[model samples]
Target chain A: MSFLAAASTNINPGLKAMGYGLSAIGPGIGVGIVFGQGVNAIARQPELTSTIRTNMLLGFAFSEALALIGLVAPFIYTS
Target chain B: MSFLAAASTNINPGLKAMGYGLSAIGPGIGVGIVFGQGVNAIARQPELTSTIRTNMLLGFAFSEALALIGLVAPFIYTS
Candidate 1:
């Protein structure tokens, strides 16, 4: 692990970026599942499609926000 | 944000931890939606409650696993 550290007693830029990259993966899959299931719910109830669609968008936005945050995290904390 | 740190730093642990923290948010909400909507599905059709409940648990488990991976990421790439 130290081999990747690159500098003694200091932080690493590449490692920080890699961390953000790792972070995006979970939220990416998570958003997919949320929307996919929401759509399935709507499909099962066409009459309730509007309600389901509203909630689906809400869930999707929330899930996507996490990924967006991950995208920005490295810039926020890296020094 | 860079103003919070001194000049010429090699890397930042804060960035990596923040990255992982951001990653967990999506899956957290995702699992919540999976079960929440699943419960609604069961309510709509009581006869299928058992089947819906089983699938709900399975989806929740998978979403939780993603958050778990994000939780471990900072430790993995901290080098």
Candidate 2:
């Protein structure tokens, strides 16, 4: 009985950590895609460099925020 | 016994996902800085814009690939 209780306690944290990890996947891919597209756009049109860069930064910020949200989710749910 | 096992299995995926998510941070910041610097460089010297832009995109792609690797990490670890 004691062993089972100890095991459960250990497993709970592990599962929670896993959930947090999985949540980051979308943001990770999202940031990469956004940056890749941004780079390509700039490469194609040097004249609109400033405009493109502003938009790219904005997109990057949002995507990074997604990853941050994922990191926080486990604590939010578990607590 | 069965419940504990099931819980651990469930948690494993979430942790893997979190690991993937955390992995994106460096690349995200790196791409942002690269683009920002690229833009500034172009703004300062319009004539060198073409060269600067090309180098910027190359840097961006390399940073982006880091995130791509993060996305693929889980499958690599689990398998």
DockQ for model 2? 0.10
Candidate 2 chain A: minimum summed lDDT over ten consecutive residues — where?
A1-10
Task: Flag regions of model 2 displaced more than 4 Å.
Answer: A1-79, B1-9
| Tens-digit per-residue lDDT, B1-79, candidate 2 | 3433323334555565555556666666666667656655655566786788689778877876776676666666644
Per residue, candidate 1 scores C-alpha lDDT tens digits across A6-31 of 32454555666666666666566766
In candidate 2, which residue pairs clash? A15-B11, A18-B14, A18-B15, A19-B14, A21-B17, A21-B18, A22-B17, A22-B18
TM-score of candidate 2 on Cα atoms, chains taken together: 0.54
Identify the candidate with maximal DockQ: 1
Second chain only: TM-score per model? Answer: 0.74, 0.83
